[model samples]
Target: MLRALIYCLAPPPPTVNLVSNKSNVVRGKTVPNGTVSIKINAKVYMGRSDAKGLFNIKITTLAAGTRLYVTVTDKYGYTSKERVVIVVDRIPPAPPTVDSITSKSKVITGKAEANATVIAYVGSQKIGSAKADKYGKYTIKITPKKSGTSIKVVAVDGSGNQSVGKIVKVRP
Candidate 1:
């Protein structure tokens, strides 16, 4: 009598985590070292995964928001699922510019990222909120306070990213 044994074999799918940093940089790593590539409009940036399957590639300054496609090729010639990385305008709109501050009227005008949320602050108290128009202009009304009181206007993007505060000394 003769008997035969059968065996089954297959490679596991690799693991990958794509991350974006505060500096607007994206980095990713794979479970197993693999080759990676980032596709731009008509260009490709390639990098080889390290022993730990980690790699980073800095995207050159983009003119505007861009969509990035990344893929990793494993040692076994298997490619990872494609990932789409959306690089929004990470750059917080410029710090709000205090164009005018009328203490008596309790109104403040400023310039910020167009359509950004602008808040008028009195110390820790939030007094007024306005959305900058397309031209990055905004006029917010708040309550009048003591003279010499310092008020600040801060702009925040849709992503909840804050901009530097524009401080003004109220001459109430």
Candidate 2:
């Protein structure tokens, strides 16, 4: 007699969803179709506009805070207007000039000592806060509800100026 065996295989790879939102808009009245070009990270990905003044493009993979450029061409054969510094990252880039951030024992440190007065935002949602100390230091602690979470931070000065920094990746 002969013996038989059965085996099971893992599932296929998951699909990557492309999420797009209105990055920026150029103001004009007589803007014609094929007059606009949407550039992501300094690369022209989509050109021309539809009847509704809307254009859609898919991005396979993009890091957080990817800067975007939108340009509009005038009927007079000239670059009518251009919008720069538009970011495509779901969460905006965190503020720069962070004195330092330290993580320990599943708890992050350095928000309070940085003199941070407001909570940082990642797409309109506050993730963390850091308040400045007498020595101009701030401390912030971040603990994600789930593992492999990505967050952004922005710091504001007393003069109301904002600075952006890199995205913070949390490891489980």
> Which candidate leads in lDDT?
1
lDDT of 2 at 78: 46
Candidate 2's residue-wise lDDT over 1-172, tens digit each? 1222111121111111233233343332224453655566556754554554444444445543555455655445445344554334343223543333333323334343145453544456776776666554555555543444545666665534455644555544
> What TM-score does each of the candidates earn?
0.77, 0.33
Indicate the TM-score of model 2: 0.33
- Model 2 residue 90 lDDT score: 43
Q: 24-74, model 1: which lDDT tens digit per residue? A: 345777644677878878988887778987776766756445667788777
Candidate 2 lDDT at 84 equals 51
Q: Where is model 2 poorest over a 10-residue stretch in terms of lDDT?
A: 5-14
Model 2 residue runs over 4 Å out of place are: 1-107, 111-114, 141-143
Q: Pick the candidate with the highest TM-score.
A: 1
Model 2 residue 22 CA deviation (Å) reads 32
